[model samples]
Target chain A: MPERIMPGGVMSGVIEAVISLLLVAGGIFVFIGSLGMAHLRDFYMRLHGPTKATTLGIGCMLIASMMYFWSVDGKPDIQELLITLFLFITAPVSAHLLAKSGLHLRLKHADKTQGKPVELRPEEVGDKPVPHPDKGHG
Target chain B: MLSIALYITLALVVMALLMNLYRLTIGPSLPDRVLALDTMYVNSIALIVLLGLWLNSKTYFESALLIAMLGFISTVAVCKYILRGDIIE
Candidate 1:
């Protein structure tokens, strides 16, 4: 009869399986995010797609990297932690600024699936009526 | 075991890179392009980290860090340009 595998071997196998699952799951999330980027109609909505995916997906990949390195060296591997930190910090801010700039440029939102702009009342414009000579002309 | 994981991660990263390229190519608006470029930068950093793992070298982390820092600056510059029509003004 073949000898049974040791508990330690089984445990290692389980850990490896978990890491593999994480890598595949992260990849799927990234692919979905890209699909969202492609399918979304408006630039503002598209901004969310990659930002969410890259942050979370890169995070998952970094965790897998840290785990793999720690297992091999028998010590904590911290470089991935730094990369994760950088991603978390920058992704949102960059996305926000990009979206804001898009709005500032008055780029027409592409979701014409909805109808024309609803005109706002004078009070809605509030505090600042049309710039005297510049309005209803340009 | 480690090598296998590294290769799998590399393949995934390359796939992600291709997706970003698609976004960069066909993005409808300027900000859309910028957003794709930003995503590409982040993915590139992740790719570098994976490469470091595959090569068993700590040195590649430096490039990863540089990518992160420079990537942010570039995004900010692009955003500024979009908002003001000039990066410096």
Candidate 2:
């Protein structure tokens, strides 16, 4: 019956079910991740939403795509595989850069974030000037 | 049966896209909006993949790739603009 679902290659009934299930799961994960983005209070917390949840979500979708094309199209399409690789490689780099930019701009951080950002004035940046009133002549 | 399942999945993904839109529009900070846009693009890829399956087409694959590249580049560009007023510099 499941094999009848496709007009293409050699997918069995069980494999079809698995692929569909995976697709649904991936969709749900993507939704949850986006939901976190909308719902979380702070920007850094919001970063977690897309970076962690959506990354996994997209990864799942790519795997399902790979499996579906491999069996139904009768060719092991590596395009999805490449996307998967590209996403996994880039997601972290983007997240790190985004977070770095956020920190660099001195974006407001949640109270719970450890290691509070140092308040560096533009003039006092170089030579590691100590913040002692005794040496505080500007 | 499979069609029915795919339809349900499509609805869920659409709902997610709506959420991303909400964040993109009403997010308090620039970073929040940028994050929303990033997540939205990723969600769009998922939607395109689902649409491809529904229509039994492969051409959407190229579109998805384009979205992936553009989304990343735009995000980094915007973040750079935020960190420094000039993107090129």
Candidate 3:
């Protein structure tokens, strides 16, 4: 009877361990971030929670993926990098737009929360009237 | 050892997903829900990457990328709707 051993089995084991550690850490960050989102009283504060967590958490996980693939296949697997880049660029923009809209809608928060007052846009307040200084001449 | 670590990672990700779900359900306003959903999208991307590692396949990375792109667009559209009451002019 002969014992069989899979090729690259040991190396795969090491790679998997590393990737798993990376993922667990990333997940912890994400979980904490979500908790912040759920527990925060104000919309603006909640906005910061997810933005920081999602970006860093996703970035870490993507790097883990890149590491795992590069180790096993010995090439720079760049797909994960592209995903990270996309997330980084868009997360802040989306958060900003949402915050701006929240302000526009006058979303209120609990007392003791000191957010800057929403700047009333001229059009929103109906304060911008057409110029009528010369209307009598017409 | 590797299996144990993978299982732990999976558990943590699942916990994160559950937390995000809670936020989505308890959100008091529309933007709150939108923010929670956006967080879920980001978490989902991370989950996909971890799945790729566990399954030992690079194909899942593509799905993660797709989610990132689609999630961003959807969030933007939702924000626009909330701001102006319409997505298209």
- By summed lDDT, which 10 consecutive residues of candidate 2 chain A come out lowest? A121-130
Candidate 2 lDDT tens digits, B1-89:
45666776788789989999999999877777888888888889888888777676687888888889999889888876766665764
Q: DockQ, per-model, please?
A: 0.44, 0.53, 0.59
**Model 1 Cα displacement at A73 (Å)?**
0.8
- Output the worst ten-in-a-row residue range by lDDT, candidate 3 chain B: B1-10
Candidate 1 wrongly placed segments (more than 4 Å): A1-11, A110-138, B1-8
State the lDDT of candidate 3 residue by residue for B1-89, as single tens digits: 54565567678777878988988998888989999899998888877877776677787777787888888899999987877767865
Which window of ten consecutive residues has the lowest lDDT sum in model 3 chain A? A1-10
CAPRI verdict (incorrect, acceptable, medium, high) for model 2:
medium
Residues A21-108, candidate 1: write the lDDT tens digits. Answer: 6666666666667667767878867877788976788788778767756655667877779878987898888987886676665457
Evaluated on chain B only, candidate 3 has a TM-score of: 0.90
Per-model chain B TM-scores are: 0.92, 0.92, 0.90
Clashing pairs in 2: none
| lDDT of every predicted structure (CA atoms) | 0.71, 0.77, 0.77
**Model 3 C-alpha lDDT per residue in residues A40-136, reported as the tens digit of each score:** 8889889988899768877877887787677767788778889888888998899888887777667887676655454455544223432346663
Chain B TM-score against the true chain B, candidate 2: 0.92
Best by lDDT: 2
Instruction: Say which prediction, candidate 2 or candidate 3, comes out ahead on DockQ.
Output: 3
